[model samples]
Target: MHSAIWTAVSLFLIVEGLGPMLLPKVWKRGIITLISSPEKLLRRFGGAFVVAGLVIFYMVNK
Candidate 1:
């Protein structure tokens, strides 16, 4: 379980790096846009991701 968690995190980091690595200008623009977004909108977007992740995890485990 511990190793599995670390592997998942490592994969996530790799994926997170791809945007900046492959398309730095686009990624920077996206980061700037996200920075200007409203706090409430960001919260809702983050919450959606959390819920979706939880659903995916549950389905995979089952």
Candidate 2:
């Protein structure tokens, strides 16, 4: 479980970083847009994504 979690985190980090590494300008624009969004809106979006990720993880593990 520990190894699996670590590997998953590593892969997620790589995937999250790829867009910025490949297209810095677009990534910067996206960051600027995100920065301009309301805090509540970002929190809600983050909550939704967390729920979705948990559901997918449970489904795959089960």
Candidate 3:
């Protein structure tokens, strides 16, 4: 279980790094867009991700 958690985290790190590593310009543009977006919208978007992650985690564990 410990290693499973670490493995998931490691994969997440790799995936999170891919945006900048593969297309830095696009990533920068995305960041700029996000910066310009409304705080409420960003919070909602982040909240959605958190909910989705929780659902996935629950399904995986079950």
- In model 1, the runs with Cα more than 4 Å from the true position are none
Q: Please, what are the lDDT tens digits per residue for candidate 1 over residues 1-62?
A: 99989999999999999999999999999999999999999999999999999999999999
lDDT of 2 by residue, 1-62 (tens): 89999999999999999998999999999999999999999999999999999999999999
User: Cα RMSD (Å) per model?
Assistant: 0.5, 0.9, 1.1
Clashes of each: 0, 0, 0
Which candidate number would show the highest TM-score if scored against the true structure?
1
RMSD of 3: 1.1
Task: Tell me model 2's lDDT, rounded to 2 decimals.
Answer: 0.97
Model 2 misplacement above 4 A: none
What local distance difference test score does each model get? 0.98, 0.97, 0.98
Runs off by more than 4 Å, candidate 3: none
* Per-residue error (Å), model 2, residue 21: 1.1
Question: Quick one: RMSD of model 1?
Answer: 0.5
Please give the ranking of all candidate structures by TM-score, highest first, separated by commas: 1, 2, 3
